[model samples]
Every structure is written in structure tokens, then in C-alpha cells.
Target: MRASDPAIRSALDHVILIKAHLLQLRESLTALEDVRHSPRGVVLIRRCMLDVRMVFEELMLLSVSAHGEAGDRVEQSLRKKHRADLKIRGLNELNPNFFPDAIDLVASDEPGVAGRFTSVCEPYLTVEQAKRIYFRSDQLLHASRIFMSTEDFEAHRGELIEFYGLTERLLRTFEIDISGTGFMVLGHLNLDDDAMPQVFEAQTS
Candidate 1:
């Protein structure tokens, strides 16, 4: 896809939204500490779960946006499927290449010249990760019986922390390769104050 392609633009827009979601996730995670002893602690946990779930959903939508029309079809199909596992499986089938295996953080010492940098291509937050978190969130969000006790809820705190860690690593500075054209690098220069999506493009090898 060309730099000016609408799909690229849309994907970048999603990136912006994802950044906002991440910010919310951070707030929810921090609040967990303050409420750990309070009865409302469960609320914070639910918020965290919701935030993680949103990130997963937005990531899927962003992937779909990268594919243009084909992605649109997958999105339509996803709308009818309420199962998170199926949605992820369908997206994987649509095109696994749509998801980046690793993100390259290119550093440039001079203007307009790409330089050496680090690559984070670890297999974190893959489809399986999404499925696990998504379904867990669903289970916690829609309680079929009495809500989890504080002890039970506390047990899952470790998992929530892990989710945040993996998500941060995945989005800290990542590259999404656009087939046939190039790839887009989406991240934040300063995640605290500069929460905006900083996007850069480069040709694929």
C-alpha cells in the first residue's frame, strides 16, 4: 500500500485510538493498587479486563484496516460472530501476514536517513494470547453466578499484570508491514506526555 492509501490512513487512525486505550489501561492498572483492600477492588479489575479486551478488539480492527476491501469482508463476518476465539481464528485465516511478527524501531541520526535500531519481534501477544485474554475478560465481565470473591479476584491479578506487560512490549514501538508497498511504524516518542501516534513509513525488503 502506498503511504497515502486510505487503508494506511485508517490503520494509523486505529493506532491513535489504540494509544488512547492503552492510556486507559494504564490508569486502570494503577487504580488496582489503591483499591486492593476496598470492596470496589473488583471494579478496577473489571476495568482492566475491559481495557485489555478493547485492545485486542482494536488490534483486530487495525489489522483488518490494513487489508482494505478484503479486511472489510472479514470485519463484516466478525460482526456476526460473537465468539472471540472464532474472530481471531477467522482473522488469522484471512492473512497471517497482516500481523507483524516483530517490530523494528529504526533510529536515524540524520534527517531522512534510516539508521541502526533494535527489533522486538518476540512472539508475545499472538492470536493465542488474544484468545486467552479475550475469553477471560468475557467470563469476568458477564458473571453467570456470584461475582468472584476478593481472594479469587486477587488470584487473577498476576495474569492482569502479565497482560499489561506483554501489551506494552507489543505496542511500545512496532512495525506493521503493508504487503506490496512498505511498512508503517507506529509508536509514541514519550508514552506519558506524547500519547499521540507517531507513524513512519519504509519500503519492504
Candidate 2:
């Protein structure tokens, strides 16, 4: 029998709906380019682009912000619900720090970390900037803390990755003339060389 939770179905529906809009926008833009010679066509195309951008920016924000919206009972139920969050099961109970150390290489059945990592990044990126986002491991874990339930974490994980991928694709589609998009990546850095290799950096570069 198929698992049929209304909440799960709703979440899936939302993601699918969001992706469908993106597909429509892509199609519309492709269609728009063909009609570029007409002033009315250009205006309409510009409007569509604006609308798509606005809609997706809101979506990306929603995807990230919704992570911990499930409430404290859900968040603090780790011991009682061992399999509730896949991260908890995968996490080393004997050695609690195991998950933090392996976060960089860990891949769940769903895109848990990947999605969280992706959503936190800005859409427009230069070559160097893109590298920073790819390496933003620490921030991803910090953000994933809210996904207490394995079901919830796995369920919405792909959306985060999609959000990040959307940014890259949007930049490509528009040739993103980002002369001054005023976007920057912020991360922590370790300052103490004598602190030990085990310590994380203490600065954002």
C-alpha cells in the first residue's frame, strides 16, 4: 500500500507546482525570443521575466524558511523517534560529532543536505563566487538543524537543490549581465593557527 499522508501530498504538490511554473517560464522565454522584433512582444517578454523572477525568489525564500516550521515537539523528539529523522539514525549516537565531520560527503536517500546547501546560495554567481557556494559546507549543516523528522527532511530536500540550480539556470538564460548585482557570499573562517586542526575557522571571507 502507498503511504498517503495529506501533509506529504501537499508538500509534493507545492514543489511540483513550483517546478511547473519554472518550466512554463522557460518555455515562454524561448517563445518570446522569437517575437523580439515586435515592441509589444518585447514588453510582454520583459513582464513575464519579471514575474518569473519575483515568483521564484519568493519560492526560494519559502523553501529555506520553512525548514523548522514544524514546531518544537517535532524538533526535540530525536531520542523518542530514532528513525524520525534520517540524519539522527545516520548520526553516530556513541560519537555525536560524527555527523558534523562527515557532512561534506554525506548523501541521504533524499537530497537533504544538497537542497539546504543550494537554497542558501544566491542565484547570480561569478566563477569564483560559485566556488564559494560549492564549498559552503559549514553553513549547510547549521541550516539543516531544523529538519527534525526524517520524513520532513527527505521530503523537502530536493526543493532546496532545485532552488540553487534555478539560480544557475536563470543566470544562464538571461546571460545575466551582473555588472553590479551587489551579491556576496558570507562564511566563517578559523583565525587561530595554534588552535588545532580540529577547530573550525572563525572568520567569514
Candidate 3:
């Protein structure tokens, strides 16, 4: 895509960088299939850390679209924290994936934990909703944990299993190994098996 606005162009550059970082993350993770306990994935993720920030910079400048209020939080986190933290606390606030907020649950459970999460997330979930919310680095990291979950969630969940078993050691590996590999797999993938398209549409878009 081409643009006449310098800021918008800059934003696209950041988006391109984000895409590259994600690709690298995938490559590193996939590399661990044969190499046992490889730190390669973590290393790649570290490199992409900066790229993640760039994406947010561009997104906010462009303001080209919206993923609801949650997106605003992601943008703020990028401004306040380093790229590395984005994976830890920025990911969740920016990208909730399937985790819906208040607007999503207004019709379902009104007095449950899910409802609570949604409620806090709502009024601010959509760009049209609250207009803004406090975005923090921790939220990004917390969000990434879920955002980068493995392909087969049902088989090995909450086991703290990273990439095959790396989830348990995410701090050291930057994990969520799906390629049956180690951190060398780089921690990026598109498929959210059995997930609704809307779950990841914001990120993919």
C-alpha cells in the first residue's frame, strides 16, 4: 500500500517490521523441533521486541482503524514501555484474542467473572466505546501469554507447556512452541484452531 501522509507511511513501515518479526518468531520456533531446549526462539523473540513497538507507534499515528477500546490500551503500552515488555504486558491489553470484554457478554452472563472482565474492558473495548484506557507493559506481556498459545490448547493447557513444553519456561524461552520445536520456533503463528475468525481478525488485519 502507498500513502501520502508521512506519519501513515511511517506506520506502514512499522507494520512491515511487525510482520517480519512475526515471521522470524515462527522460523525460530520451528527450528527447535530437532534441537532440544533451544534458546533460538527466545533470541528471535527478543529481536522482534523492537518491531512490536514500532507496530504500535504506527498504529497510533495512523489511527487508521480500531479494535475497540482494547486497541487503545495496546497503543498506550507501546508508548510507555520497551519493546520487550510488549510480549509480557502489552499483548493482552492490545490483543485480547478470544477473551471478550463487557460489550461481548452483555447478552450472556451478567454476574460472572467473564462478565466482569468484559465490563472493565467494555465502555473502552471499542474505539467508539470509552475512547481510551490505561495501557501498561504488564498487560501486554499477560496478553501475549494467551495470544501466543499453542495450536492444540485442549491437549496440553495450563501445564505451563511452552512450544512443546516451553510454555512452562516462557521467561527463559519466550515460548508457546507449536512447531514441536523449542524457542527456535520464534513464537508466531496464524492458526487458532477451532477459534472464531473474529478472535484474531484484529491482529491479522
RMSD of each: 3.5, 21.1, 15.7
Error of 3 at 59 (Å): 4.9
Q: Residue 100 in model 1: shift from native, Å?
A: 3.4
lDDT of 3 by residue, 1-205 (tens): 3232333333334334434543444454454344423244333333333333343344242232222344455556656765443433455333333111222222436455342212222122232111111132123234234333234222222111222122112111111111111111112212223321111111110
Q: Sort every candidate by TM-score, greatest first.
A: 1, 2, 3
Q: Give the TM-score of candidate 2.
A: 0.29
Compared with the true structure, model 3 gives a TM-score of: 0.29
In model 2, what is the error at residue 129, expressed in angstroms? Answer: 12
Tens-place lDDT digits, model 1, residues 29-134? 7888777845577777888888887777777767667557756766676678877777777777665655544455577788886764466656456656767878
Candidate 3, superposed: residue stretches over 4 Å from native: 1-4, 38-205
User: In candidate 1, residue 133 scores what lDDT?
Assistant: 76
- Stretches > 4 Å off in candidate 1: 1-3, 37-39, 102-114, 121-124, 178-190
lDDT tens digits, residue span 1-205, model 2: 3332332333333334444444555555555545643544434444444334333322222222222332122234323443323423322232222111101122445745342222223344333332233233223323343423435333223333443354434322121110012111112111122221121111111
Which stretch of 10 consecutive residues in model 1 shows the poorest summed lDDT?
180-189
Provide the lowest-lDDT 10-residue window in model 2: 175-184
- Residue-pair clash count for candidate 1: 1
What lDDT is obtained when candidate 2 is compared to the true structure? 0.31
lDDT over C-alpha atoms for residue 119 of model 3: 22
